[model samples]
Target: MATPAAYDGLISHAGSLFWIQSGEGPDQLVTWTASDGVSLAAPQGFELGNEIHAYGGGAVTASASGVWGVSSKDGRIYRLTSDKAEPLTGHTGDQLGDLVVRGETVLALREGTNGDQLVDVDTSTGHVRVLLQSSSFLSSPRPGPGYVAWLSWDADHMPWDSTQLWVARYDDRSGGSLGTALLVAGGHSESVLEPQWGPDGSLYFMSDRTGWLNLYRWDGERTYAVAPMAADCAAAPWELGYRSYTPLENRKIAMRARRDLEDHLLLVDESGHSETFQLPFTAIKPYLCTIDNAVAMIAATPTTAPAVVLVERDGSYAVIAGQEPSQDEVRQPERHSADGIDFLLHPPIDAETTWRAPVIVRAHPGPTDEISLRRDPQLDFFTRHGFAVADVDYRGSTGHGRAFRSSLYGNWGSYDVEDCAAVARHLITLGITLAGEVFICGSSAGGYTALRAATTTGPFRAASARSPIIDPKRWEASVPRFQRAHATALATGATAVSSAAIECPVLLVHGLHDPITSAQDTAALASDLKTRGADHELLMLDTSSHTLAAPDLAAQVLDAELRFFRRMLDQSESAKRT
Candidate 1:
């Protein structure tokens, strides 16, 4: 069976809803209505994915007339009608995304060589005009009645590290005029995200000032924290157009909260009283918006694949679109009872096996991101083949509080490597797997962790890293200007663990066109391994990017890695018998 496709960019229009269906081919804009079940708004090969923040989201927005989106083939915005798509903005070198339509003008965030800024485009004339500029990054341009609000930050801080919320008087409908942007909230150590205009004309946003991302509102005077909780109501601003919370009618709010890697849907009343609803889902995408009395989001559980679901205020939900996983395809992972860290242990699917199953400890990408309790087809492939798996939530991962996530500050490789080793040792002590059969694998940041783990005294027989960061010092040059400090902090006290110390065989996979992590780093590491006479192999993909959006390439890489693992395990077992 093929892996399920994911959905995002949920937007509610005039009695109709639309979203972007990704993962299969080029992302297609899908529209749904009560009259028609579902239909494609854009033609085939008209992809909506963009590269604004590297992992772009919110690339599509709906106006009264039609839908406007950033074309994946080009960075220009297009007005996608039912028949054909027409360009709304002329081509510039700047990457445009996070589109929001306001009357006859469409506002978008443009990332250029100068910096990131907000620009307005005429729907008819396709004329682009700069609205705001002189910021390292800008996002979430929410246009209200007579004003527009947005979030901005400098080169010294990431969006999640520190951001400033601003509001300005914008009157583009009457000859296009914009006022001086005034600071609303943020600019401290707190990270603010998703500045949106509420139904009551107030500006509502999420802030992490109290160590947790909670909801707050600005009533044109003072900002008030509404329904404050110890859980994170917002995800890291990795992309644009993520909405963790949305305002409902009658001063109520519908939000999603993250605690211990599990997602909970919440309804908060005006008095700060919250009602948590129990659902089978463990992870819910932040692409959420309220429609009438119900809320729509893409949600997924450990056993169930992601689906676009419309949940009512009464805790009842219906699947709008997307596939659900079958019972045989789902595998539940048990939480490990570690002392202080969080880890999940997934057993082999075949309980009738007599031999101890080989274990693969996973280190998820975005050393800052955590592995959610959602159904992953790749991990399930290992389990179905009689191999156990452990997903480690190393230090610096989200879903925990800020302190836990900030623990890896200036200590990236050390903390993550130690955490993976600890989990592996714990599994071995419990007799879940033998020493020679344990393996470690990861992608991107996790790839760095897996490579570092092989240098430690861990019980890992082999390591596989996809698009891994081999040298932290070399990685600093390729990151964004705002993330240089983070890269420096990660490389400061980091020691270059030699491949000679790693006795286990290694498999390295990388995409030649990866913009985030350079392919040269992987090639250099492979060279070092070869010079040191270390057992290693490198696979290079020509057309794949950092995320490997192509399904065929991803499947091929997975099959290659699995085959490498089986070969290494067989060799180790043969050596033991000899």
Candidate 2:
């Protein structure tokens, strides 16, 4: 029962670290100081979460003065004190998130049924005023001395696919209204993210103008490339408040560059001279904030769990939230490349004691996501049970250039499926797995790929899909507005998986309350499989979300998956013996 606690949304203000913690209990906002250590910022019964985009981030913001966050129970902004939680907004039915503080205003991105709006909440009066509201989506509403910068995109594009960086002057004459806006950078092909105001009053942002997301500086009049590199310095803006880099003291920049499927921390100077700093972590989250001369991030190693680490200039760090787990006898990944696709192959733990172990081919979700060499408890569970796991970074994965990621724009189903199958075949050729013992599993988009592979490909003996998208077009219609465009793009050439074509034993597990993928569609697929007499089992969890992040539910899922795979393996072995 490995219920590893989860940490996210790391930020620093006035030498105090604030982050969101879950899994130990209800999700809570935690504040850490050198003097007081770690303590809950909210009351004991209060849970903090942001639901702006369905998949929320940047739910809380803090400074030396006070701490403010959006409550998960009610999608309203709340100001937290020592023991009291006061709601600042009425029951407007609008979700507020991506919280930031500037002057005396708490700026947040408000998502309502009408659309998205960038608004400011007065710290003293709790007055909500719309700063700008025309784009279909808005994020990162950063307020500076005399200007406000944010990222906006239309309904036809995801923030990563395309976005525009805009800045507007603040007119204090009429109680501080945003004046005429200026298009600083970004267009249809260019994606911009993390607009931060530097100490020198220049706006710093990450843009993929040259097909690689690099650092740039905007001095109001013109934009200049600060440190241009082939590697991407930003991630897909799946959630708000994503910061890949932060401007430090003396015009210096601390950033995480994704290269070779891992994150490397680098320091960029005023002259664009970059230096790499070695650290114990290989995977870094999409949040970075500066504390004094050091940077705080949610980072992890291949063997250690994810933690809120305050990293110094010389690459040394101290844990702020989660502690570093033990590294004893951890199974390291064997990086492999097959057909220009990258994957991390983890052999069964104690492989010497096993004979012809089965292999699990994992298709990562997002279909646009990448799998780093981080410590994954699920992967460890499979390997410890005599199962080799192949964590495939199929096409459309980030960290690679924009071309590689957008290659699946209209070819999502085919390209990603082919890549995963190619990795399994490559493993078979290397004698790491047997041909008849290959299994495939995925969640969300990856689950769709697993179902497609089991139906089309022969090497796979069993398949597992959790909250899978049985019908792409249907999914596009059911998903939130923020993901509708991206889903439509990915489902351009993909059709629904036909249950009648499934021959291999399949396991379907879906959370009834999954917000992203359609749970009703999964149930329909289960019914279809049953009618067709397909060998399958459907495990419907009553209270799990998309990831089944709960400890007990996650454990149940892992145990069920292992049992299903082993049953198939035993049946195959018995047939061979007969």
Worst 10 residues of 1 by lDDT: 323-332
How accurate locally is residue 58 in candidate 1, as Cα lDDT from 0 to 100?
74
Per-residue CA lDDT of candidate 2, range 202-321, in tens?
Answer: 999999989999999988788889988999889887888899999898899999999887899999986889999888788999889998879999988887778888888887878877
lDDT tens digits, residue span 106-190, model 1: 8989888878878888888888888878657788999987899999887767787788899999887766657888898887588
For candidate 1, give the lDDT: 0.82
Q: For model 2, what is the error of residue 24's alpha carbon versus the real structure, in angstroms, after optimal superposition?
A: 3.0
**lDDT of candidate 1 at residue 484, scale 0 to 100:** 68
The lDDT values for all models are 0.82, 0.86
Q: Please, what's the RMSD in Å of model 2? A: 1.6
Candidate 1 regions exceeding 4 Å error are: 324-326, 352-356, 481-485
